[model samples]
Target: MTSPATSDSAFTNNSCDTEKIHILDLFAGPGGLDVAAHFLGLESTGIEWDANACETRYSAGLQTIHADVRTMRTERFDELPDNINVLAGGPPCQTFSVAGNGAGRRALTEVKSFIKRLVAREESSETIDEELSALGDPRTALVLEPLRWVMAAIENGKPYKAIILEQVPAVLPVWNVYREVLESGDLPGGVKYRTECRVLHTEEYGVPQTRRRAVLIARLAEHGHASMPDKTHKAFTRPKAETAPTGMATLDEAILKEAEHVERPRANRKEREPWVSMSEALRESSKKLGRSEPYVVVSNYGSGGDPKNRGRRTSDQPAFTVTGKISRNVVETPDGQPLPRFTIPESGILQTFPSNFPWRGRDQAQQVGNAVPPRFGAHLLAAALGLEEGRVAEAIEKMDGWPQISEEERERLRKIGCGDKGKCPTKPPHPQG
Candidate 1:
């Protein structure tokens, strides 16, 4: 078990009043956390800036305030239902992602300094605005927006009962600062919080992707304490691993002989199932596309520019973290014959979105790539609320796959379509809503 951010007692909140709680999700991209809250039967009001994301959220029947979170004040939240007691969000991570340029990397020092100032009650709105302008990338400072909201809520005496946050592993240190401040009573008031921060591999929670995120959960209630959820599955086996990392099962040479690709060894006793492979998730897409044998997706860019970093994942394994430029992943037959890139529907499935979940507006890929897998979010929210994971089953509404495309649509796509480096279109022309 991960250590608590404070020396407070580990209070297993057995309060059956979880249903009375609602959530206010910040930087609420397409309602990822809201979806999870819904699965736990919790109502939510989300604030987001992206027009496209708001459209998608509204279409999904989620409540949303289509505006920048920075403009949100305590007064705006006052209009929400009185049941709002949980605050959750995953900030835009482009600046913090290791896959990006060094903008977020360079801004880390200043961001940390800003955190310290906030904890010291020295950061004013004018100072914040000036420093945010200096950072060049405004999103880098967005990670601190949740802290602002929490502070505002506390001052208003409407402190949240629970708080949940997620970001790339690069943001772990920032969250650590948050952990210390919340638990050490470093805020403006004497209200110390119980908190825990850890890096969680999504595959271990049964997400069909190998994404890892820094998660922090805190609660202000007297009996409130939060910790990482127990792993339900094992980590995906790497192409090469001399030793297994924590929470990952060790695979001996003998176990590697059972199949062409090694199944991630089971770690927990609760569920011994293998990690869900990309093949398992897109079996129908493979059949429809007339490709059943194993294949490779070679991305145009990877962690860096190294050809060795050409982000490649075989069908038998969970996919690498999908990115905003996900369409750049080029598919090729096992024998090295080039094929098309992944279709939008296939990409949505990789992100664990419903098959027919409508992706609205331009930059659709970014919306899908940035979303938290609803499945993973459900597990985290359920665990935080001390509720049975079974509650999510009834809440998940299934949908159909991509609608069929007409020849007219096909022609239009071909005329305007291109791939990374001007390659041919991946999936056939379909409606881009």
Candidate 2:
């Protein structure tokens, strides 16, 4: 595998010095972070192995390298250009997700131990790979791929200036362990990173879903001030019931009726904006599809440990966590009239992708479901790079309506930088809102 030729051109669109910050995204599913990078006028290349997702990336004119991250370890690290000073990725989370088999959660202890050994150089790469192979599912070991690349880059004398990683909430402990090793300067070149890891609520970041992700951000110790981004929106809270009035059919009925009357928590405008709701997000799509009435989403799966008790959320609330099975959820009007489930583009909207983002190939639902919402990614990138809040807001505003570039324009932009430039916008005009 050969690295794409480096370019010194500056992206004149945003405030960041684009010539100095290039990102390499690993396990980059469907170009979520890459979209965020592009909105910020930063150059990025995604390494994804899924053909379906690669097809979507190709259609969207994003830069991509169709390869497994594991193969990029060690000597292959040299194949990456030296201009890549930033590393960002959300590795496969199937094993760690609640919807998954939990193989990664079960192997957390072993994975943590491997992290220590790798940082200390206590074992050969082959030995570690052999042990990792025994961990039931092969994807379980992919979570550690980011750290391996970091170590490899340090040894190659090109340590990334900033590193951003994210996965399911269950991976927080793993990130905690990473925080330790990274800050300890125990790796090959004794590079010390100022790191922070925590579980972030997507709703607080303005995504129209209530997903939680474990995020880790690190910067070279000398870079100064590395921390999680501040919440830009208020968190979503379930509505509570108020006391029933004098005339009521029954306690249950009264509770149900009065719940809507109860005041939900609200954020002071000076503090943060209110959390985005499903209705607001789908409003445009609903209008285009001629759906104006309120609806409820009846989940396909069980809730509260009872298979019969399916979870339900009204259109007014933020959506429940979106999974690959999103298409399986049922949508119905308040009066029990059946409605169409969210379309692929609607699901992408809920995940904070632009409504017009070109989704191609098979398992498009999975690609949308698994993506890191571009709005959320922009916040994380801004915080990690110490950009101003205004810059983050600007990037997110553009995401509200990402334009669909023409095929001819896409071909021209795709040739701007390296042969595999994911989202290198030379002068991405302000997209129409």
- Candidate lDDT scores, in order, read 0.67, 0.77
* Model 1 ranges with Cα > 4 A deviation: 1-12, 74-77, 240-271, 288-291, 303-309, 392-433
Off by over 4 Å in 2: 1-16, 238-270, 408-433
C-alpha RMSD of each candidate structure in angstroms: 10.6, 10.5
Q: Show the colliding residue pairs in model 1.
A: none
Candidate 2: worst 10 consecutive residues by lDDT? 424-433
1-433, model 1: which lDDT tens digit per residue?
A: 3332233222245333554667888878876677666656778888776767766665666677655566555335555556666788987777767555445656767887788787687657658756764686766777787888788788877777678899877677778788888888777677777877777778887677888788888876464556666676888776652222222122212122221222335354465468888888888777888765688877656333344456577888888777777898888888788877877768878877767666766677888788888777877776666665456544444322323445565334323212131332233111111
Mark the 10 consecutive residues where model 1 has the least summed lDDT.
424-433
Task: Score residue 161 of candidate 1 by CA lDDT.
Answer: 67
As for model 1, its CA RMSD to the true structure in angstroms is 10.6
Give me the displacement of residue 318 in model 2, in angstroms.
0.5
TM-score of each: 0.79, 0.84
Q: Write the per-residue lDDT of candidate 2 for residues 143-224, one digit (tens) a residue.
A: 7789988987887777887899988777877888999999997877688888888778899999988887888998877666
